[model samples]
Target: MWTGNFWKQAAERAVKTFAQASLALLTGDGMGVLDVNWGDVASVGALAAIASLLTSIVTSTVGEPNDPSAVRRTNP
Candidate 1:
């Protein structure tokens, strides 16, 4: 169930996450950022799955609304 606003929000979150990841990569020392255990790996995997799902939904329903009334427009 993807709507315009949901797509926008998911895109925003993805962009922010990428930015933060880029900064972390640049600022962290050699081993500090590279360090990852099982829990961290699982968490990242879950996040990736969720992001993938959101992206798929957004792509599949580019213009449709999950709920039209929830979205505000100026042309109405």
Candidate 2:
């Protein structure tokens, strides 16, 4: 049930959330290591998952998906 806007919104929301979280950490003047669970960093988790999933999907669907899509031109 995802339109193109779904991906767009999700990306924007993630960026904003991450920015806010970063600001919070920086402003706290060394919140310091308290051994936290860090569930709020879902943006990072989502990014990692997306990267891995896309890598697998592309690699499986097409050979060498990470490679450049180009046609070699031979000099005459």
lDDT of 2 by residue, 1-76 (tens): 1345434544554555566665565455455545433564455555654654444434432432232212234579
* Global Cα lDDT for candidate 1: 0.52
**Backbone clash count for every predicted candidate, in the order shown:** 0, 0
Instruction: Residues 1-76, candidate 1: write the lDDT tens digits.
Output: 5457665655555665655554554455344545745355455545654665466465544434542122344575
Displacement of the residue 50 alpha carbon in candidate 2, Å? 9.7
Q: Lowest summed-lDDT stretch of 10 residues in model 1?
A: 63-72
What lDDT does the true structure give each of the candidates? 0.52, 0.46
Identify the leading candidate in terms of TM-score.
1
Taking all chains together, each candidate's TM-score versus the true structure is 0.40, 0.38
